[model samples]
Target: MTLPSAMTFLLGGLLLAGSVLSKENPAELAVPRDTTGKSQWVANHYKRMMALADKSPEKFRIVFVGDSITKKWLDDSGSLWADNFGSEDSPFYALNLGVPGDRTDHVLYRLKAKEDGGLGNLDNPAIQPEVIVLMIGTNNLFPPHDAEQIAGGIGAVAKRLKDLRPDSKLIICSVIPSNSAQKDEELVIPANATLSALAESMGDDVRYLDLFSPFLDGQGKKNTECYEDGLHLNEKGYEVWFSELMPMLKETLGLATEN
Candidate 1:
């Protein structure tokens, strides 16, 4: 079923509010600052995922995990998602576990079970995914965090995923390029380099996909046509990203190389 635009708008608002409120609310101290909310909207998203898992645990094969970049795959107008994974006949069944504004720490937190301050309840074997596509650390580059720090945060997240979902193959994407005027390349480049190294260190279970270069222009700046804002990708950008990602996914799933 198609998600209604009005509902999408409402959920988007709630997510934005939850992200903002999480930062300063003392009650959020126990949880990660990015996903510290019990709002009905938040609960609804999680419930929907759980319901899907309940319906057919074995069919839930892929999960895209990260921040808003991953969350926005549900956008009503984006056929990039539908054309690939939306059909019942498709080989892969996927879940979106991306929360808006999530950093590596927040994702790590979300992957944990409730007993460990996470919403995933991953201790239950039924919820395990076959593959997890992880892209984060862009938010951590905002302030006070150096490239190494951001990469370290992503490393921590990868390690947690390994421990929590040992059977899942990880596709660790290089953080996408941003059009920020503040020399975004300085941070994104080194951070991506670190991520590449991290993926290498994790052995064959982890694969690194460089998503940054495809979005860059001849001048090494983000292609304006791909992004609505300096940071977020537009529909066109999503198309570009999916183009780069689909082949790798097909290979990982052992599907025929011919799309």
Candidate 2:
């Protein structure tokens, strides 16, 4: 395919085949970020996960990838994480590869091959997933990005994830509800709908999980009871999420095993 002289390629440290970059979704282009506090956090967490994977790579069964919400599965979820996710004798050990303020492109940068400047966990055999869950896209809900664009970004990430781990069952989760006035149901609802369709179009091994449904109240608002601030989840919120996720995880594991 020949390109126009005006067009430029998305080069460097990004997995293009499994990327979130295109003309329409250019805002979500995958690129490594090194902002001050965020850079420190990303480096620290990446190192921690690498160390854990190096020590007992085989113990990693479930890998949840996303931003702060997924990262806090270990922090805010507290004992819930300890007891259910990775205690001495839990059903499965998990890797929390969530980075705060991550967009789809950022995740793609991280998921890129080590030779490509990414952490390359996907390329690591021992750190592969039995069931991998991708819960991102919320961070990309800013100006000029609509629901379709966000969903497209997530779809790109899902494709990248499966390409890296074809043997693993992939779960693409909808952006959970938050109290951000900007990221209200107007945006989240349609984005999730598009993601649902995207999952089905991807075929049998890939599926979509909705995090928006259970995290709501009778009032159809962000259940303040489930939120830490306006966005991130508190302990109560994780409980709400874990209830749905646990069943899905078990079922996904069984299906993955059968395969």
Candidate 3:
């Protein structure tokens, strides 16, 4: 499914334009109020992703879907991306389908292709991913939504992803501990527990990755060293994430352990 050189150039141009616009007003690039009627920035981002999926010569074997944490892998932690997935010769081609400030509902909305949302186009046999790494639900804990609502939202996302790409292995990550949410155990703890349980109940296709302990201290407080703010991962945090993630990715995808 390689694209012609001219088409590739045109796609690059379109992507650059979208990127420029997204950068101008980053807030508008997050999940839209109406997934079916995505903002211009969101639409551009989705369209660019679809174009890349359609034209890339390599198969998209690994996909990371989440909010800012996942997006940071491409932006702040780009060097890590190069270190892990930069090899053009490698069989694994990864895509980051993260929108900043996305909640579980937003993710579910994005996965709904019938309504012209999600990356559902990749469900086409040609570009379907071999693995989809999902880390969401944290944003839902902000206010109003309780643990049950957040968990339910995530459950819906997992179900939808399964339905959309049944053959792909789904890795559901626990919402990492945050500075602000650390003391609010009633909300954070229960939400993560629910997510873990959801993964366990989903059978072999879904695996839960708990990154909480690694990012927390013995007192169950967020390790300030790992985060730039209370929420977002710093470079050191990303290092921890990549270290933990690589092993899981290898095991799930049956890739060689020797890196």
Candidate 4:
């Protein structure tokens, strides 16, 4: 071969190798916790959780995990959380470990062991709960990831959480459908299915909560009235989420009635 032809072939091979490396299991890889730019608030939240774990982890019977959508609920739901989970009459206490704009890998990072380079919150036995509710992966769907890759990322986190606390239950909420049904069909729907399967495979203590349909109107468009920005939920959206969650909480925690 001419030198120029050989150079072109070598360059092509290098490019293909790079593509393969780039595609390396991003979903399953546990990236470090990000605490910059849009996610700067994560640092403070992490600190708060670690301190709470050190001080009083046992008080938290329910741990909610997800992205901005989950964080906003803790910030905005106010009485909804207190009246049911934190009140004197309530049977369970809860903690919010939601980090805004976080993808599946970021959450896996937080859930992994510190010696393994994650935040290691789940490594603390005192932080064990009766049930862990996870509503993540919407951010992943918003990206170029397919259903399988996203599910893999979410599954890694879910499986690890259950593995760490074998006796505890896990409820994996389906990705809340986006504004476009076509996109939801492409990614969200299948991811939801995989989540359901993943929950079942994890055993009887694990469950998959379907939170997608309630957010969609009869026409299948995301209900605008329920959303604040076509992405995050408004109070109406929270009500939709809350209705689903309340029943799951009661059933999973084995409570006789809603608080």
> Whole-model Cα lDDT per candidate?
0.74, 0.80, 0.74, 0.82
* Predicted structure with the largest lDDT when compared to the true one: 4
In the range 36-144, model 4's lDDT, one tens digit per residue, is 9976777887887667566577667888888888888765665676676654345667777787778898888888888877788777777878999998888886565
Instruction: Please provide, for model 2 over 1-259, each residue's C-alpha lDDT reduced to its tens digit, 9 standing for 90 to 100.
Output: 3464324454433556555444457534678878467468767777886676676667778888999899898889968887876753566678778888888888888888988777686777777778888999877874537777788788889999889888989989888885674576677888899999989998898888888888879977778899989889999999998887877788878744323
Query: Residue 12: error of model 1 in Å?
Result: 50
**lDDT by residue (tens digit), candidate 1, 41-102:** 66566677556546656566787888878878777327867777655456767767766666
- lDDT ranking from best candidate downward: 4, 2, 1, 3
Worst 10 residues of 2 by lDDT: 4-13
The number of the candidate with the highest TM-score is 4
> Judged by lDDT against the true structure, how good is candidate 3?
0.74
Weakest 10 consecutive residues of candidate 4 by summed lDDT = 83-92
lDDT of 3 by residue, 1-259 (tens): 4579889999999999999875442211224444355455666666766665566624678878888898788777748886666455555568777777778766765666644754464455665778899988777766536666667777788887788788989998888886566434766678778888888898897998888888976786788888888889989999988877878888899988876
What candidate 2 gets wrong by more than 4 Å, as runs, is: 1-22, 35-38, 142-144, 255-259
TM agreement with the true structure for every prediction: 0.79, 0.84, 0.78, 0.85
